[model samples]
Target: MINSNDYKIGRIMVGASDDDVRYVHEADNLPYYHIGSVNGISMVTIDVIGHEITHALVKKTAGLIYQYESGALNESIADIMGTMLERYMLPNNWNWTLGEDAVTIRDMRTPEIYSQPSRFEGPGWESPGNCPFPFLGNDYCWVHTNSGVMNKWFHLVSTGGTFNGQNVNAIGPHAAQQIVYWALANYLQSQSTYSDARWSTMAAARDIYGECSNEHRAVIAAWNAVNVISPVCPGSGGRIAAEQIENSAESIMKVYPNPATDFVTIQLFDPITTVDLQLYDMTGKVIKAWNTKESTITFATKGLVPGIYTLKAQTPKGIYTHKVIINQ
Candidate 1:
């Protein structure tokens, strides 16, 4: 019997101090898993056990709503924890793929092979009601399909990779597992979105690894590759004269993907001979400065941490100041 104090589920304790919260016994023709065992001993593999147990933990903690993004999160958490458990149990032989014994259902390292979108590209994805795969067309909102995005996130955070032009430093699997667990138990709400998961995971990483640490930055990069735009970290506030700069700028200037990553485009109504663009952090630190003559400029957001930044554009016509949000 696992003691309640042996492990944690968010801020709450788990299992009973005197009783076993989980039971595994022999049964006949069970439906693989739904908090219970099956008839065949082959059905009780290590990966299967790990996956189901993680689900139990999730139920005890967040009781994650089993639909849409939240449902996908629940599933992704289970898969991630399960895979980690498999690695723990068989470190020499375990693989990053889910399922086992001639039945590999998903591969976390590269979900695109199975027609899953590892990157959550907002509205560019199919409608929530439509399944990208025809066989599971009836499944509401393609919860399983969407699980790939978070799965890939976990994979990249654990193994390290160059994704979407960002170099994610490897945090390794154990730290990755612990950070994910912390996020799931503490940061994620019942109906969290992909963006919410990004924020929650980053917050968890920041708490465990420190804000300036490489782990925190890697978490941000991993989510960014998956197109989960995160809000700025705390302390990005209290800028003097921030409003005055905005009021002086022309209204015709536009920046897209308001909460932006990769790059943000600056568009102008009138062509200018020379335009100077300067990006400032909350503390009035100039992060990126550009000088150009084009009416439209695409500014790269690489290496900038998540936060609200001030963009001051100086043109022959007028001085334009705009607020741009760079999400992880």
Candidate 2:
């Protein structure tokens, strides 16, 4: 069934039957799948075939460009989905590594085995030295190398791990795959970065597992473990005790003097580690910002017009928002 609108099925070809290799290429607005001879040793390995199939899916979904972080993300997604399929089909026989039977192409379990950084603390993405495939016009951009960050993230999310002083509960591969594919198809863009990946995956997990669910929390922890922070995820930066602040009823935050002429006092019912306070006007523009480790902090509203404003407090206990009116 060949349909122009159907990306699942496409033109497939087999070449170099006497050589050991496989690849996928698109030419003239059409994709072609090629398989090479592997000396009849593990020629039918589902893992390798699945890897190529995932590339097709990536091109169809995110259409990720093959450069920089986006390219690395592209390679990571292909490996992720490919390995996931291999594991699902043969749970006991499969392992957290690519190239199941052919000399261990890459190890997803411990990327360091191949000198890939499992965390994002390594070299910067723009480091010219990290660029791979110099002969191919530097199009690789350490795609396979830096992919370890996300590969480790997937492993942690699927199997559970303790990272960055936080414990993540394993939701199994089923949940991980769902959240990952959702992010790839919906949240990720052509130029999305690692931070964007974190946000998208968290959003995907949120949609599947609810904002306050354990799965959603695991998604955040897994990325944080890899030192990948989400710029858009809630309670991201104001982490207390190295964990995101979960909303709790015990630690109640109070704001005094709702109709204040000059200042407002933010008081916490319980002594917490830290708090990020933000004051915004009716237009949602931030009027003031403060980071305090004290139990209470006062925000001055002097030299301001009389109007309604919002005061937001971010703490390890959760996020609290209140309405304040300033009258002169």
The candidate that wins on TM-score is 2
State how far residue 67 of model 2 sits from its true place (Å). Answer: 1.2
Among the numbered candidates, top lDDT falls to 2
Q: Which residues of candidate 2, in runs, are more than 4 Å off?
A: 1-8, 11-23, 26-28, 37-44, 123-139, 231-328
**Each candidate: what lDDT?**
0.67, 0.70
Runs with alpha carbons beyond 4 Å of true place in candidate 1: 1-43, 122-126, 129-137, 231-328
Q: State the lDDT of candidate 1 residue by residue for 156-221, as single tens digits.
A: 988898877756778998888877876676557788888778766775565455554677777877
